[model samples]
Target: MMMLRKFKIVLPLFFVASLFISSQTNANTDPNPKDKVLLTILKYVLTQGHYHPQTIDDTFSENVYNSFLERLDPSKRYFLQSDIDEFSNYKMQIDDQINNEDLSFFFLVYERLTQRIEESKPYYKQILENQFDFNNDDIFDVDYEKSSYAKNTSEITNIWHKQLKFTTLSRLNDKIIAEEDKKKEDETYQTKSFNELEKEAREAVIINMDESFERIEELTYSDWFSIFINSISEEFDPHTTYFDPVVKKRFDISMAGKLEGIGARLQKKNDYTKVSELISGGPAWKQGELEVGDYITKVAQGDGEPIDIVGMRLDDAIEYIKGKKGTEVRLTLKKMDGTTKVISIIRDVVELEETFVKSSVVKKDGRTFGVINLPKFYIDFDEKNFRSSSTDMAQEIERLKNENVEGLVIDLRNNGGGSLKTAIEISGLFIEKGPIVQVKYRDKNPDVKKDTDPKIQWDKPLVVLVNELSASASEIFAAAMQDYGRAVIIGGRQTYGKGTVQSVLDLNRYHNLKEDIGALKMTIQKFYRINGGSTQLEGVHSDIMLPDRYTYMNIGERDLENPLKFDKVPKATYKLWDNYENFNQAIDNSKKRIATNNYFKLIDQNAKWLKNSQDDTLIYLNYEAYKKDLEVHENESLKYKSLRDYTSNLTYTSPLYEQPLLEKDEDLAEKREAWHKNLKKDMYVEEALNVLSELKIKPQYHLVKN
Candidate 1:
């Protein structure tokens, strides 16, 4: 079966190459011959090469059908129930059509969607022209998943009317409040009447919708086809995706960790572009104004007038936000606290240094310990001599050893993983010689990846700090340490369950075609812990769990669609390290401390509040009611403000070796200073230090001094 699986994957490459060459020479005059070629190759690779390919049967077809519609019209504002009924005919036949390389279903949906989009332009324009009755008590359900498609034109029109009204009402309230605040500051200040403010709000909505529609009109057929292809590709797993040429370039830039932009990652949430993460040492991060969860509503270049981006596509919004180095980009954000703030940042090349491993020495209760923050398990595939996480980590640990640190805390929080080879090498640094992780390709025997070198770099007590975002390579290192009793894992419930390994296959490489066919990033293998457990949907459980804001939220691999199931392989033969005299005692001591801690109690409460906020999706259209709701939420949020302000008494400082480097680079010094300040405010780091203090090393296991 293993040989057959290998043969199946290899045979297609040769077959496709010959077929592609022949097809190109005698190419049909189809508008997008590349589309058919791409579709055929993508399907072949996924089905043959995927670690756990889904049977492309009726069930898979139905999944692709539903997923495509949702991706195209998540809010159900475009396609009506009648259109869905028409498209339902191919719901079960998609499998057969895909096998036949027929794009009839995609073409039908794409054409219908384009038509609906063009026709629906007048819905928002017409609705916004008239004044909204804010006095009437109307509610709009923001949870589109629970809502059904509109039955007819009137139903869809009503849906658009309520959505526009809800948006306009919020803006009107903000305008009115701003005017009142201005009058309060200066008694001579002229305040606009309620009617005039309302009109301005409606005009803003019209401009936003018009711009959004225009952007949508600009999308090529190829753009829609990418969405269609992805809907099918993602059915196998969330990580497996088909990247078009444009998307592939962006992916490569992200991997390189060098780009000219605001250095903030944005994701499209409904009609808004939300700030997902602010890259450390980037312009936005240095500015200290933008934050995760804030919705960007408008963007302006330098001193130019702010252009509304409320309804713009994610890509389009990103283009407006990113610019050449030394340019200023201004963003108006709708803050999480129901307030708006405009922040300006001078864009610069996002420094990649922050993403690499950095260590800080801190003294707590007269004991010195080292804290190493590894953002990701990075490696440069093209340049083998380039710096990697494993090499950098070993060097950092050696530097800490020179400082005579008693214990170490490896911070893997928010690390979304990178090179698999680096993860094994890093794990090998702590252990003498043993299997670090077990990897299994489809239908093949588990391959035990071991540390052939018998040298133990750090024999001292080690504690790994992780969160829900720590994934893939992060999980591998943490899991290996946990299995071997080499380190105490601390932080969230578990790491992100991303055990699958993916390899990006350049589709254009299969044939000598000039056309850009793009690439496919597909899963090829799964990694397992040495103890036999697979970190597919159930990640490595931390020895000491910490209360975080994402505790009650639905996150991690299980929350994703079509995730691989958890399974176990035969445990690798290895001896556990018995170096610690009080490993269990340290965990118990930490747990007891956390139970009595007020900060943790407040964090738990805040997590519940956040989950409740996520679940409550209804929006009041009436101005007074909406204002009251916002005020209530704002007041409630005040109780948890101390969680942000809570700081530990411990002081963090740069190692003696880094002082000279810091003196030479002002930006580096500033970044390190900021990081140290943040460490002082980190309760988790304080707890890790406390645990490290309790972790007494056995006398026999102590390392001899040079």
Candidate 2:
């Protein structure tokens, strides 16, 4: 892997990892007995992260793997399954320093290359000077084993890393000196001595480099794929992505309550970077200058030549985008068609404190109801001005109380979670203080996170709105509220099962091995509800699943590969409240209404049709029949196209929605069926909202289970 110079952040899952926020509480990292028991229980439940080879062409004939290895080693003719699967035996304990071809042939090849490099150390410079070619078809006529270079290539390759490190020291020093000189030139009056700054920068770069390499070599393909996918995803749009746990953690950390640059979600499609989803009220959304589907072609400083960002890795791209807040950056964009435009986005220090600074009200359900839309359950790092999600939620309740709202809805849908502290605090908003969540560790006892405050923020009838996107901290708050019988969990069947907690291991911070290279993020903990239940693969179950068309869509944690499974710990001591007696009646009434509702019925029928549709893998050739079938289905799939502006923003908006099922007019029913099948799911979201309305005003039972 090629190393580059850069700054760092506890990336991926910022909040969960607790990377940079200085005000974060000293996490409850102490060892305990219950944690050990839970760890034992979790050995099987926690990690479904197996790298199952999907293609049986486990043989090298699969062009993808072939191209993959070729990129890594130019002379690598081919690798066998024996080379790949040999490591199946070493499922958990993977080591690179040790030669273990017994692990797999992939290891064999890797070791082989390492051996080759080490055997010919002095000649390591040859690689940098020349390209490593496996398919010499592009360059030489020599036999595969025969290279133009000296035969002792193994020694050279093995020692290349360390030797190059030593050799590059002078180059690093020179660069440091140059940077120091530049800093002095830019200095107004006060400046650090060149020697002092140079020393710090040099140490930072070298140590970061070493730490980064160690982490990179040990990363599994599954982990590597997220970074790779991220690199690819940016070209499409910013929101859609595939983040393995590690990267996901980094994301949390990078955006923790606006700790980084202007808060905005980003995705990569290809060499081109596209903006997708923007945080509704964050810097980007507030600016209202950027839009989803707007492709970011280049990112520059307040004033600088637009850098051609094509083909750059996603991480590098993000590093470029993030810097000291309050700075100004210019982004050159490409519109949907091909129109080019440039816009300036000012970098603002994300004022995460805004998350808990206040709350609002929404009048509904024949009564004024308080609305607390918490996108993330965040906590401020400072104790003096500690703005926690729970604390803020409490304040919102006070305002709502003053407004005299009869009911309240805590919207946790699409919430990916943040502070555990906030989750407990928020849950306490509706109940008498008690344990809200149980946290288990790998080698210690599980601890009950309790709300010690004597006062309840709001005791009025409460409802928690959740969807597949609600997870982790979201789950904890919702689950606690539900377990306490203080609120109704309404919306989807369950939330996203991102229940694990991770800690950041600044491989560089603590070790200072590599300088410009970033740090390693590791999964080190798991969370559980105080009642022994966990929000893992099975997120918090809703009291009532709503009727919505999007209920048909595939999204959230359960859809993820190798997600952690669900299991429960022992129940905790707590008081449960029961007030709504018409819960089931309300659910039944809603279901009956939805059964006859037009939008609900059409979506239901569409979903059923899609369930049995073999349209995805079929073919038809009749032209007349094909055109008819394609025409009808295309319109049906987009049954609400005229009603809903669901443009993908890929091509320009069509003047009419009467586009063909098959753009080329090839298949008849097959293509039509495919379109309908994929289009049917989103109807569920509508169904969900309907379910909520059904149970909105049923008779209440005030007695409690406690």
Candidate 3:
């Protein structure tokens, strides 16, 4: 959401694991026979364990070949037509090779890719070494998703030329703005000519590309092998992926939501490791010194000399920063304005409570409501007494019940979901022992996961808030709640649409192999709502739809490359929640309020303009036209700025018990206060309360169960 203007690189740096492998490969450059072993085990899983097993045939082989190439070079800027032609011979033969447990195709492609990368290094360097003619009347189409591979070296050279020029222009634009700002700040400030700025931009590009090539050299053969293996596994489904041991470890740590290190998401952006997001209540966020978009230039251990990480691989940089709890890691960061600072943070176990279930009490219109924000349906698998979202949510509900809340609102915005078992348990809190969801596996009839518990937690007026980012378990909870007429689903047009469930299988356990080949996360089941509708491509629809920034964006499972299709099963026999009889009237009242709401109108316009900008792929090479377009966009974007400041005249406060806890912890109190302030500004929450008010009205008709 925070867009850093000229610092943005159009290309995705590298696939997470691929770049990590590329960074750490220099020390141990040994041949890994595990590739064949991994391939064998992966194929077995796809064929035997996958929900939708793909056949290993000519068709599958050709897809594997193309998909691998696409993964290797998504921008179509690396390999050429000749490379594709040379690799065409193995297209159909890939099926035979995989069938025979061979690695010929993978080996051929990986070797050739390595060779092309080495050969193309100088091409970008030579291009960036010279000054770019920004005055030239040319436009670069940035959408390479539909573009074809280059025909020859000449064509590839042209593509590289355009790429470098585009990058240079972007950097130059940033410099010009900075110089102008400086001139305004100082009366006697001198600004450099366009040519001088152009040279600086080119030099910057050259330095970055050189660092990129050097880092590429660190890529081990095993890393590329993982990429290829993942390409094959992903062909089955987008959710299916092969994680090598290192990546698997990182994946596990991330899923656990607690790690003994600095709690900031670090990403490799052109030779610099940028702090992407800070985990709230984590070390970085708690320190309040490290910030999103801050470039980590150097890292050091406790009292140790700082080592420069400017051109270091992100994985290596992370290694220097990540330490055991109670240890210290120092970071040298570069700010956006080109200022530098040193910050030392004592590493601790950052438990990501923000991603867990949390509750707040809102008092509006002389009535009280409890809002529960469940970012993810997290579950700790290792510990027998591990905390789960279901238990946490139930506790929060009980806490809210003690406050005597008149209505309840569950906010699942941006929750990508977690344990399916947790989802069922969470849903059970609202209903009196019934089927939560129907899951279907390969060739198996739908199995109804029932919550046999007959006790209802808070079967009163309820509302759920979701957005396009809400997915999987979130969708399951929302859909089940919607089907039972237990709650009014609000926000986004639809959820993230991820209906399928993935189970991680350790490859070592598959064949009882003694080696740590890695793990495979494969989609093994698809879930359906209690009303029989699949939440696959079509996620759960909101009972009261609200427009947000992502309303017009292609960001759901349906927008993914190879997502599972939506279908239906027989509806389960279940009783609906008889709590709200005037649900339809309440929805109508909310829609009427939304129709005349100025905040929503502005949001709709912002969404439309944002989508238009996203669709605009062409970039002007001429600086004048480029600046003009950018200024137009900047001016247009200003109108939406007021939306962030828009706050409703509503009050949100913590429960009495929570207030004492907040009082004890100043940091927690501050966070909750900020959260309350944000909630006041949230138009969707305001409307949800209105829905709650309407739901509190007596029903004209009796509620019935299906």
Q: Model 2, range 664-695, lDDT digits (tens) per residue? A: 55543343344333333333333333343444
Best-to-worst lDDT order? 1, 3, 2
Clashes of 2: 95
Return the TM-score for each candidate structure: 0.92, 0.52, 0.83
Candidate 2 error regions (>4 Å): 1-313, 316-354, 357-360, 364-366, 508-518, 547-554, 559-561, 600-638, 641-706
- List per-candidate RMSD values in Å: 3.4, 18.9, 8.9
For each of the candidates, give the backbone clash count: 0, 95, 1
lDDT of 2 at 281: 42
Give the best candidate by lDDT: 1
lDDT of 1 by residue, 1-706 (tens): 0112232345446776765665675476557767777777787788878989889899999999999998898778889999999999999999998887788999999999989998898898789878989999999987787899999999999999988887788678768888999999999998999999999999977877777777888888778899999899999997788999989998888656668888887776666788766675578866878876678987889987567775566788898899899999999887655546789999998776767899999998888999999987877657766889999999999999999999999999877777778888999899988999998998898999998878888989999999887888889999999999999999998887888877777778665567897888888889899999998878889999999877876567787778888999999999998788999999999999999998999888887887787567688988889989988887888888898788888999999899999999998899899999999999999999899988988886765322
Against the unseen true structure, what C-alpha lDDT does each candidate score? Answer: 0.85, 0.49, 0.78
- As a TM-score, model 2 comes out at 0.52
Q: After superposition, how far is residue 469 of candidate 1 from its true place, in Å?
A: 1.2
